[model samples]
Target chain A: MRFWQLASFGGFLLLLPLILGLNDYYIFLTTLILLYTVIVMAWYFIGGLAGQLDLGAGAYHGLGAVVTGYLMIYYNVSGWIGLVLGGLAAMGVAFIVGFPSFRFGLKEVWYALASLGLVLILQKIFLLWTDVAGPLERYIPFREFDPLYMRARAKWFYYYITLGLLLITFYLAHRAKRGKLGLYLVSIRDEEEAAEMLGIDTRRYKLVALLTYSFITAVTGGIYASMVGFYHPILFDGWIGIQTATIAIVGGLGHFWGPPLTSVILLSIAEYLRINLGGTIPGLHQVIFGAILITAILFKPAGIGPYLESLIEKVRKR
Target chain B: MDLLIDFAISLARNVVLGIMMGSVYALAAMGLALLFGVANLINFAHGEYVMLAMYMAYFFSVTLVIDPVVSSIINIPLFFLIGLVTYFLFFKRVINAPPLSQIAVTVGVVVLLRNIALVIWQAEPKAPPFTIFSASYEMGPITIPLDKLFATIISITSLILLYLFLERSKFGTAMRAAADDVDAVSMMGIDTGRLFLLTLGISMMLVGLSGSLIMMYQAVTPTSGLLFGLLSWAIVALAGLGSIRGIYLAAVIFGLADALASGMWDPRGREIILYGLFILILWLKPRGLWGRR
Candidate 1:
């Protein structure tokens, strides 16, 4: 990474707690933003790089949450171990769906629809799998603050952990974007036939992209379940999928730094809207938020990424 | 044999309802099919246009105390103008843009329209004022609604008119030519831009008509478009991309399938059955029932 990028990220981390100390509400908002940032970065692997719009992030997220919940409840596993197992299970499911989709030449809308179906299917499964999943929210045992169980009584710990995860996900995305795999994926996105003609193993590369995406998203899910201390079918709702796509698109999709930036700005705006408009008007906040999205899309379809890049270019020229 | 008779009666009632429901599906899918077939845009926000039509219907009913049936006539032209404006403002610029960008734009529209509805109307479900014809009529162990019958008739008549317009008229021919190959049609001295706007206007008007008709039987809400949108997508996909008659046939089949599943199983399982069929159909025949290879 560039010197400015590293310095900015480091400064943000160092200053996050200091800012959080100012208000409890800001801490909660910061943690939520970090969690969504993790999910958006995960989406970038397949959506931004491979150009496959997988609308089924909720499926992997839900699966990871269910796995963590089950491990914690039945087997009494530590949250740390549960997180790893949750990620593995999510990856296993991704491979099953991704392999068939890639091999069969499903691209664009077909892939988007198929991935959407995965979330619906998983939601049903979680609903019916009453024994392990439980009908209501499954809670992890509350204990004193422990790094081993990954359970914390305060928001400060979650803030740091989520920040750490965000950094790792950023690094991974940056590496992929700079690597040969990134080149192949971009080629597939731009023109599949030409890429194949140029001897790119499109299917293999896509599968790799999908696996990486699922693993990162699943990890986010694990952290989410622990932080919230509950898991339910509602966690995998279709709206979540829509929100994932919205965050990525709004942030300037296909850019290395876009998703996180978008997540922070949009989530904060949504929270602000909810706080102000939600009490008096039940759904007005959503209305204004939706309007913002529509205006952004109508006017700034390339997202804030290209605009920011141009601004940087102008500065360099000066 | 009474059991058999009951089953037969139930099936007949459902079949009629399915056909009635299919008419609305046909209208909703027409605009999306036109856009996808001609311009190759999936248009994730296509349902929002339908929602907009419903709100328009509600507005006319509430303000002018006009019957929804009468308001639908007004909506046709009004929504057509809105569609035209939308095309000029947003879609026209991105006609040949990348698919991801197209999806993003439409999704943004969907979010904006849905949120607009929430702001203006709140989330409370609203229904357009209905006349006596909106109620159900009992015919000796079977129930049928007059509004649904009217909706079906109007739907079929409009579709037939659309078919004639597309197949026989010069402008329709120009639109078809543009859809087949925009560059080639432009080379042949046709204005492809005008054709796109025309297609968009007509398609959105059809969706507006369906929205008015749908309010006769079901209540309208902000999120109501989500199910209808998905159903229309399923119908269009099943019918093949560009075939009007195919959309009609596919909608009928899907409506019947949906009715049958609801009758045979719990209502909650209806989505599962429909989506399962969608996956199976795509797996077995990716081009759709009538889609060209």
Candidate 2:
């Protein structure tokens, strides 16, 4: 691992006790941030490296959540087993959608629209599949702290679980970024036809990217369902997908460390702002957040990742 | 027999209403189609412009005590100016950027404009003033709301005018040529930048018109743009990216599908049906029915 990666991991460990010592409110916010960090990392794989912006992560996340919830409820399956099953299920679905879409040569807006349409379709299916999920929220019954059930009353437990998941996600993202897979993804992102011309099996690589990204996101969804303790159709809402894409873009798409860093900072700020302004201003934080997003796009189009890298370089030089 | 009759009647009514509603969607999507087809830029904030126009009509009707019809008349040029300024200030700069950058820029504008609306109008849904024409009118066994009828007529007329202008007029031809090949069009001594500005202005004007008409049927709020934006996207894609005629057809089909689903099933099912159609159509016909191959 690089020095900064080590430093980031060390800093996370050091900050753990400080975070745990905080009040329940702060712990809740921190836990939420960690959850989004996992998601952002997952998004970075396809969005940042492959340059195919699939605004349909929520569909996979929601499916994973529902699948894990059902397995635990009916089959007495452990959360760990549920997580694996959910990941596999998500991979299966991703292949079904991603194969036709990528193979048919849909890119940019066409691909974005198709991916978005996938979310909408999946949402409808989920809604109609009333046995698994419906309009009403499906709650996972609170069992006494059981790792098998993935049920816990303490926020700290959820926090550690999410942090662990975030670590795994980071490892995968790092591996992909430095390997031949990463180069192929970047080639596809920059130019698909050119990548194909260069003897790269563009379709196979894209399929692999989709499967990997979906599996990670599905695991995050399993954790998210356990954290929230309930699953509803609203989980599959378009806003969920939009916010994920927004967070990924804001963090600097394609950067190894940018998404997680952006998630921690921006989501923390959002949480703080929400606590301060939510009651008094009513949607003011969203307004300000939206403004920040616009400014980030306008000035720092490459995202905060590049800026952070340069700043670290300058500090190292000193 | 009675059940079948009820279903048939319901289906007929929904189909009619769907056609009317679809016309509005088609009108709303025209500007988006033009921008995407011609400028090669997807304006994510296109819905915000529609919101602004709706608010403008609402403000004039309520604050200035002007007639809603007259307010729409006034809104046309006002929205045209706003469209021109927005394009010149923001959109013109990123026209040459990559699709991702273009998307990012427009999304930024969407966020900024939406937040501005929240700050200015608050989150409350505002109902625009309407006349007797806004009420429902019954003919034979069918009841058609006058306001919806008026909206439909206005939308269809506007679309007809747009088609004529694009097909018959020199400016429209220049705009189409610029959209097809900007560099080639410029090489022919035509000012492509001017064409873009004019196109943006006209596009926004059409969106404003649609927004004003929408207010006659439904209330407007800051968040109202969300549903409309998504629906317009569905329409644009279903119509195929650049085909205006396809948009109209797609809008009608979507409207019928939405209305029938709601009328026959639960109200929420309407959303499911509409989105289902969007995905199914794209899967079956990726290029859209009327889109150029």
Candidate 3:
């Protein structure tokens, strides 16, 4: 029964853009939502498994977008190469920021603030850095559909790409969770002092989680830049970091499939609200987002993931 | 020689401006100091509340046609209540919950408050055209704006009063004791729940005052939450906990960094310098300037 549920969902995702046939705009929006879903899922590594409240997703994501977009635009790099390079660049930044942060034993709120500051610091630097990026947005060279260059004007292509990335993120998170690394991360999250005393190199494990999460988040940034055909300093949005952490926390802190599920539902609703009410009521969608978050945090502190999972278990037994 | 002298004078001027600017920031951080240091809560929405207070200040000044500073009459009491309300609605639950839940709740409040500002006021920057304190005083080679000067004096005074209250008063002593050991304080027959509420309320009152004082000169947009929130947190991180003087000195350092970065380099680069120095400080001195506990 579980296999069938998983298989059908996969099949549905594969056919989603086709089912919505000519509505390229909706496809584009779905892709954008999935793209963020990738980031939120990747957040499972740091926030969920490792128990760090990292608000620096925006930093890594923006860095990936800038690096990939910059290379593609100026150096004529393939999108695949740009994605890899972008991911690597984000990992580099993760090391630079995370190594010191973990080494200094920064945890809880201090760690969160440090990561939050990372997004703003990077944004400001890129804003003032003129050669690669400046105050103005850098537009990628547009192509109707150059498969060779991996530049496309169609939104469905990007949607499928984001879906692929989401799968990869899911698989990576699954592997990490099931593996030895995940154990250390969980123990550290639960009791850092105890984890350290148990001979776990907590800092190294935490840094590993940071690097993995950052790399995935950056690839999404690369994909985002390509889909939009431009990358700007504003890509380093601290709000994205906050929102990603919010969704992950609300989904269920350490549960797999929770954040991705939550992102799809919440983001689609957010996009819907953005479309319908956004013109007349600018931030109504965000207000709704906030209300949902508070409600979930206050009422379902363990998140809906665990609750839904138990329901699934009961139904399966039946 | 002339170039050297010009540099020196400008540096001196920035130092003075930074100190005054620091005082107002001290008030803001003091609020967080109480909630963070005493109440043992981490509020990601600390900046959002300041942003809300700024909007309130703008609202009162424009609608009531009063000076921005006068908005504190409304801002302080109202925010105190708002803080108490937030305590009940959000902070109360997470006080003992895991840090992740606590952070999530507060970040939710950030999104709610920031977007509410966006919904009601839109994203445009808002400020009164001029206030009564807009005038400047020329002190020979250095010039001081009354708006900032008033902000400094009032901020320092409020902080000092908070400091004395914590030091001299009986209830304040309970609050301090509650900070060190909540269970012990409660066992001694003090109501810690009330102390937490009072800490949150008083801290918010400081946020209200800081917002009103800052509105005398600064224009606020929805994004200012990220700015002031990070700025206030940076001040706290630099100062550590348990000392008003440390917070003041740290805020001044940030102010100087802001002044010099904007004054000497580029205004856009100020955040870089400020946050860069902030991260550097965290790495080097996690205990901060006055971190005793």
By lDDT, the candidates rank as: 3, 1, 2
Candidate 2 Cα RMSD (Å): 2.8
- Put down candidate 3 lDDT per residue, B76-97, tens digits, no spaces: 9999999999999889988977
Q: Pick the candidate with the highest DockQ.
A: 3
> For every model in order, what is the number of clashing pairs?
1, 0, 0
Model 2: lDDT of residue B175: 79
lDDT of each residue in B1-293, candidate 1, tens digit only: 99999889988888888778877778888878887877666688887888878888888877988777677898999989988888977788778888877777777677778877887887889986655576788998889889888888888998999889989999888877766777898898877778788888888888888888777667789877766777777787788876788999998888887787777655555667777676566655678888864
Q: Score the docking of each candidate (DockQ).
A: 0.43, 0.48, 0.87
In candidate 1 the C-alpha lDDT for residue A265 amounts to 85
Tens-digit lDDT track for model 1 on A143-162? 66887878877767778888
The lDDT of each candidate is 0.80, 0.79, 0.90
DockQ of model 3 vs. true complex: 0.87
**Candidate 2 C-alpha lDDT tens digits along B6-49:** 77877777777888888888877888888877777788777778
Q: What is the lDDT of residue A262 in candidate 3?
A: 89
lDDT of 3 at A186: 99
Give lDDT tens digits, candidate 2, residues A176-253.
999999999999888888999999999899888888888987887888888878887666655556667777777787
- Clash pairs, model 1 backbone: A287-B115
Off by over 4 Å in 3: A316-318
Name the candidate, 1 or 2, with the larger DockQ value: 2
